[model samples]
Target: MDLNLRKAIKSNVSGNSADQLEATIVDAIQSGEEKMLPGLGVLFELYWQNASEADKDEVLNALEQAVK
Candidate 1:
């Protein structure tokens, strides 16, 4: 089967409001289901693509702290 996960995730969440998006993310994380990872990754990819260097640095710093 040919499946495009990023395209599928984008199509599902496109046009969502900020609160709705947040809810979706929270639900996905709280579910702790492996199936939701691709969706989260797509969301992160979207954020990374649009983020400024400063924003990227901030996220990286947060991730570094999170891993510690």
Candidate 2:
């Protein structure tokens, strides 16, 4: 069977409230599981899709700073 992981992750978290979403991100980060990375990437994709250009730039800047 072919499974689409991004779709699955997005669907799972689609209706989450801000607090619940924050909890999901925090849990994923703190748990440090490799499996959680895909879900985090999905969440980041969602945020990127909805973010303003300035917000996107800000996030990119922070990420660049973090990686340096």
Candidate 3:
């Protein structure tokens, strides 16, 4: 994926507002396929763009764990 898409995915996963993130994540989860993950990337980008350093670190840590 592109850097922007990666950043976006990271952001949505760590956003402060639960409601928007919840709906977006639910949609992605319900889709249940790699094909749908990109749509979620849009929201991810939005959240990631505004994320704090601490939040970014948390997300990166979780991602590292998931990768294992």
Clash pairs detected, candidate 3: 8-44, 8-45, 11-48, 12-44
Off by over 4 Å in 1: none
Per-residue error for 1 in candidate 1, Å, reads 2.9
**How much lDDT does each candidate structure score?**
0.97, 0.94, 0.75
RMSD of each: 0.6, 0.8, 6.7
> Which pairs of residues have clashing backbones in candidate 1?
none
TM-score of each: 0.96, 0.92, 0.60
Q: Judging by lDDT against the true structure, name the best candidate.
A: 1
**Worst 10 contiguous positions by lDDT, candidate 3:** 7-16
Comparing 1 with 3 on TM-score, the higher-scoring candidate is 1
**Tens-digit lDDT track for model 2 on 1-68?**
99999989988988889999999999999999999999999999889999999999999999999999
Report clash pairs, candidate 2: none
Each model's backbone clash number: 0, 0, 4
Which parts of model 2 are misplaced by more than 4 Å? none
Candidate 1: minimum summed lDDT over ten consecutive residues — where?
A: 1-10
Segments of candidate 3 deviating more than 4 angstroms: 1-21
User: How big is the RMSD of model 2?
Assistant: 0.8
